[model samples]
Target: MVTVLIVDDHPSFRTSARRVLEDAGYQVIGEAHDGQSALAAARVLRPAVILLDVQLPDLDGFEVALQLTADEDAPAVVLTSSREGNEFGGLVAASRARGFLPKDEVSGPALAALLR
Candidate 1:
């Protein structure tokens, strides 16, 4: 099973995502509400994937993705936003994130496809 870390500012989203991913057979190793904590948790937990939110309190998801991907054994970062994918344009393609997922479309199958 793939281990996952969920990073979002909203507690409800985090809780809901944990359920969805877990239900899909992914192991939810940890969660973070902001970019700083996300970074900290990623280091400690070392999950296989990171479901990262774009509009983080401390830093944006793109920024975080870049930082994480800089590491030699970086987890696969999948960027998520409440906004549509078109709004981000080339930002997602430019970042080191495996792909971008609209928050509403974040499901286990969708996330697994992105990792592929």
Candidate 2:
């Protein structure tokens, strides 16, 4: 099973993401509300993938992605957010994320497919 870490501030989104990923056969290893905690969790858990929200309160997702990807054992990072348009897409490209998933477009099966 693929291990995953979810980092998002909104309670509802976080809960929904966990349920969706878990139902799709991925192991929901950890959840973090801010970039700081996400980094800590990543270090401890070493998940196979990280679903990160771009508008995190503590730190932006791009910065988190940079740090995480810089790590020797970095996991694949998929940036997710409600924001849509070229601006966000440009940032995702610049950050070198494995992929960017629009919050509205993500479902259990879609997320599972992205992981594969």
Candidate 3:
């Protein structure tokens, strides 16, 4: 099973995402409520992928993705947001994230497909 770290400021979304991913056969190692914690968790947990929220309290997902993907062997990042990807105005396409998934479309299959 692929290991994943979920990053989002909303507790409800994190909980829901954990359940959805776990049901879809993904191993959820940890969750972070902010970008700082997400970065710290990534360093320690070193999950295979990170489901990062686009609008974080500390640093935006793009900033976090840049730092995360800077390292060799960095985990794949899949950006997520309640808003549509086009709303970001090419920011999502330009990010180091592997891909973008809208919040409502966050399924195990969708995430796995993005990683592939």
Candidate 4:
């Protein structure tokens, strides 16, 4: 099964997203409320992909993506937001994320296809 680390500042969103992805066949390995915690958890769990929220309290998702992808063993990153993907503009492309997913549409197949 594909393993995942989900990063979102909203507790409710994290819980719901976990349920959604798990039901869709992804193993959710860990959850983080901020960029620092997400990065720390990723280092330990080494999930195959990270579903990261675009807006975060500590550090925004783009910055997190930049740091995450710099790792030699970097996990595939899929950024998310309630906003449309184009709203992030060039930052998404520059961040090296696999793609963006609207927060409401996140799922195992969506993430898997993006990673592919």
Query: Against the true structure, whose TM-score is highest?
Result: 3
Which residue window of length 10 is worst by lDDT in model 2? Answer: 83-92
lDDT string for model 2 (1-116, tens) is 98999999998998888888788788899999999999999999999999999898989889999998996668989889897735664778888668888887766677767667
Models ranked on TM-score: 3, 1, 4, 2
Off by over 4 Å in 2: none
Question: On residues 1-116, what C-alpha lDDT tens digit does candidate 3 reach at each position?
Answer: 89999999999999999999999999999999999999999999999999999899989779999998898899999999999999999898888889999998999999989988
In model 2, what is the error at residue 45, expressed in angstroms?
Answer: 0.6
**Alpha-carbon RMSD, each predicted model:** 0.8, 1.5, 0.6, 0.9
TM-score to native of every candidate shown: 0.97, 0.91, 0.98, 0.95
In candidate 1, clashing pairs total: 0
Compared with the true structure, all predictions reach lDDT values of 0.92, 0.85, 0.94, 0.91
Among the numbered candidates, top lDDT falls to 3
TM value for model 2: 0.91
Clashes of each: 0, 0, 0, 0
Q: 2-114, model 4: which lDDT tens digit per residue?
A: 89999999999999999999999899999999999998998899999999998989887899899888977789999999999999789888888999999998877887789
Off by over 4 Å in 4: none
| Model 4 steric clash total | 0
Q: After superposition, how far is residue 109 of candidate 3 from its true place, in Å?
A: 0.7
The global Cα lDDT (0 to 1) of model 3 is: 0.94
**Candidate 1 residue-wise lDDT, 58-88, digit = tens:** 8977888899888888999999989998898
Better of 1 and 4 by TM-score: 1
